[model samples]
Target: MRKSRYIAKEVLSLFAILVIAPCFAAAQGSEQSDKEVKQMIQTQFERMYEKGIQNLSDRIVLTGGVKPFAVVSDTGDNVKAIRIRQAEEMPPEIALEVLRRSLIALVKKGKIGATAIFYTADNPNKKSNADKVLVVEMEHIFGPTLAQLVPFTIKNGKASYGEQVVVDMEKQIFNIKVDEESAE
Candidate 1:
């Protein structure tokens, strides 16, 4: 009976190691993949910024009071030259701050969910690689409020700024035009 018990313990230990080893390997691989994706996003942002600035300078017409709304994505890419319509009476800085703060707050609230995909190195059932989605929520204060921002997507490690648009404060209604032409 003692011999049987000992054999049973050995079997269980072997099983535990077999199950745990793969998980540990997978976690390490995931961390490395995440780092790689972040680097790629940074590179993409740099390239986009250079292109966006030149484009904005060439084509954007800023009305006297209109300020360029810095379009920031979840991936930390800031696309410039977005003209936001503001009330001539309201301070431009205040208007810009309002829009920026709103976006930052929404992101931190996890309103935007983003994911990243990676190929698995040793799983046949899961295909060559798999996708890992990370929902990042930032908790910080810019001025008077706690701001939260989440990445929009895992493919580019960036957030999509599609829903947020600059509006005319004088109209009393949230009606605004998105500068889609210059956005891309």
Candidate 2:
């Protein structure tokens, strides 16, 4: 009877360990995944900011006032995208210029192979919901080339595309259409 009790206790201990091991491993796995995701997001944001500032320091400086920027990140099972949006109100032109410079800097650094930038220019009037959004798609050939452009007009929070603007950035010359896209 003593021998049976010893065997039964050993079996219960083994069973408890077997059941808890998986739970402990799963908890560790979750922590590791969280750390990896956070690192990836931080790395991406740092790359964008460092490359942008390094290449376009003169163009990206905030001169008029302090414009706060918010780093927005989205991650899912299949897709992830990060956006640096203006948190505080600023001139739409400045915001667009900053975004354009950052895009160019990223392209020059060979950071983006093929990417699309969807940017919004908020209305300064603050009277109506008439923000402008511009989509610039780029492709990597020998370098980043402006593959496509989709200009949109937002009225009452509705977006309507006007025309498709296409330009080859490799040519090193293109007319900036900020006025055409800004919320005027």
Candidate 3:
């Protein structure tokens, strides 16, 4: 009887370890995955910002398609008759960078003001593709403006947070809408 009880105890200990070990490993893996995704997003944002600041022509090309509410140049503000020619070809990544810079510029110039925004991952909508795209919805500090920046979904591993924006991988576009409510 004593021998049987000892054997049963050993078996139960082994079973518990087998069951708990996988859960522990999975938790560690989940944490690591989150870290990697965050790192990728930060790197991509930094790279895009750097590239945009380096070349103004890139910005022009990117925002050329969108309607500009306010224009700021080295010479002066509100340069009338500014036209952006559509290039024969534009890479998706370059377009995305340009759009981002133009919006930042507008914000800096006080053309658009927002307190907070909501952002979500639109494309892939799966755990695997969670890191693929981020949709940002901007909440205006005041009323919305007529100036609509081109809705761009970030591909090539870019992340963003805002409101009412759909990041569609299949379409390769970020669909954005403005909300008056602050989503801080």
The backbone clash count of each candidate, in order, is 16, 0, 9
In model 3, the runs with Cα more than 4 Å from the true position are 1-27, 57-84, 87-172, 175-184
> Cα lDDT of all candidates, in order?
0.29, 0.36, 0.30
> Judged by TM-score, which candidate is best?
1
TM-scores vs. true structure, each candidate: 0.32, 0.31, 0.23
Model 2, stretches more than 4 Å misplaced? 1-79, 85-88, 97-112, 120-133, 137-144, 155-157, 170-184
How do the residues 65-91 of candidate 3 rate in per-residue lDDT, one tens digit apiece? Answer: 222222221111111221233311444
Whose lDDT is greatest here? 2
Better of 1 and 2 by lDDT: 2
Scored by Cα lDDT, where does model 2 land? 0.36
- Which 10-residue window in model 3 sums to the lowest lDDT? 1-10
The TM-score obtained by model 3 is 0.23
lDDT of 1: 0.29
